[model samples]
Target: MDGGERYQEFDPPKALRPWVRKVWTYACPSPSRTIQRIAPDGCPELILDLGDPYEEADADGVFHLQPPALFAGQMTRPIAIRPVGPVELVALRFHPDGARDWLGRSLRTATDQRLNMTDRLRDLSPPAGDPEAQARQMIDWMAGQRRDDWSIDPLVRTEVEAIHADQPSPPRDASARRALQRRFLDRVGIAPRTLRSVIRFRRVFDHAMAEEAEGWLSAGLDAGYFDQPQLAREFRRFLGCTATEWAREQVELARAIASQSYKPGGPEPG
Candidate 1:
């Protein structure tokens, strides 16, 4: 990774805060071709590539060039990405419920998929100026796209809040649980349990990175994992590698981007 690479996140406008989490930018003035593994963070994003496009690996491990603009849905697993050249892009990270409202459809159709947005987000042009300006422009566009009727489901909001707070979900009978699962599938593209697992893994990862815990064992335990073995299992499940191996990878750019999700008041990692 280039040492000069830059990444920053900006708060969205008040009107759009319910749906848009934040506007972020990444730029590398000097290019150094390096692949980065991105872990799933349970949020969807709209990316506007202002410079060279990236190459993303599919499940088969074939790297395909991405479009200049695209919508990335809820990711269930890690993905590998490499910049083809100098990287410059602005992205909108959306809340799970927000994405459902913005897309006007069930998120299940978008889960684990990346769709070209050039056609769907018609007439949207890459914003000019610096990162802050670009972020502001993106926020403006998102504000314009809002629908008066768009609102988050109360149950989904409550459940998401409980997860983030590390509190148990309100007790529900089997039938109610099934109903909530269906709603989660539509609005978040994953079940409540799955979201909890991902969020827990993310917390462990973040704590490890910040050295907030003494070691992986402590990190996992603090994040509520039952034991070291369970922690290792989650590491492999979310990152396709042991925590030690992932640390050895030393993909600085990817690490920096991931760290942004943990910023104060930032929505659950995306």
Candidate 2:
């Protein structure tokens, strides 16, 4: 969907453009626990308050934790919630670029280090500058691809198709290819090694409702997992919840939103 009022879901443009942002309704009736989940890109994430009171810092001094060091990419946090109060800010997913060739970098990483988004935006790039223009400049200087800004470019879809095929990388050149790959991964902030895994996991949503209805263990295998244990481990590591738990919460949230989402001749969700 275009950046107008039509946008209702996640969409990111190519490297040379501004990434699309979508925000759904608030999760008012949902639980209040600060559910911490990670995105496929390995970016750090946290569930927003969604109209409820949420504290970033917990009692243990764990300040609303950020993503892992190995992770650095655009982040899509909480799923859209409907049938609740109208939310001021909709959901968000990042099209990260602060890591320089790395898919991302650590917010806590010190300067004299690689590029960081917060630092670049605040310290380096001026606040008055156009963000999209700045992002484009950054990608160009770094010799990276453009953002997949839907209409003009379909790189995101192309990558999605390739990832869905579960294809491995082809043979490399005689040079230090492995080193190059590592360097690229570090620059991208996302190790290429984890791409398929993340893509496959994200694809779970393609049939989440149906498969999860049967059970996550079975769903995981059907979705390419070897066993329930394997799926469980990854789910916990990525989603911060067991398969059963995530499913239950999803079902609840979806159910709560179903009615509003299905009004006859209602606007479609992008």
TM-score of each model, paired residue for residue: 0.91, 0.47
Off by over 4 Å in 1: 1-3, 127-129, 208-214, 262-270
- Lowest summed lDDT window (length 10), candidate 2: 260-269
lDDT of 2 by residue, 220-267 (tens): 677688876777677665555655555455533333222222111111
Candidate lDDT values, in order = 0.78, 0.36
**Per-residue lDDT of candidate 1, residues 98-134 (tens digit):** 7998887898898888889978666666654488888
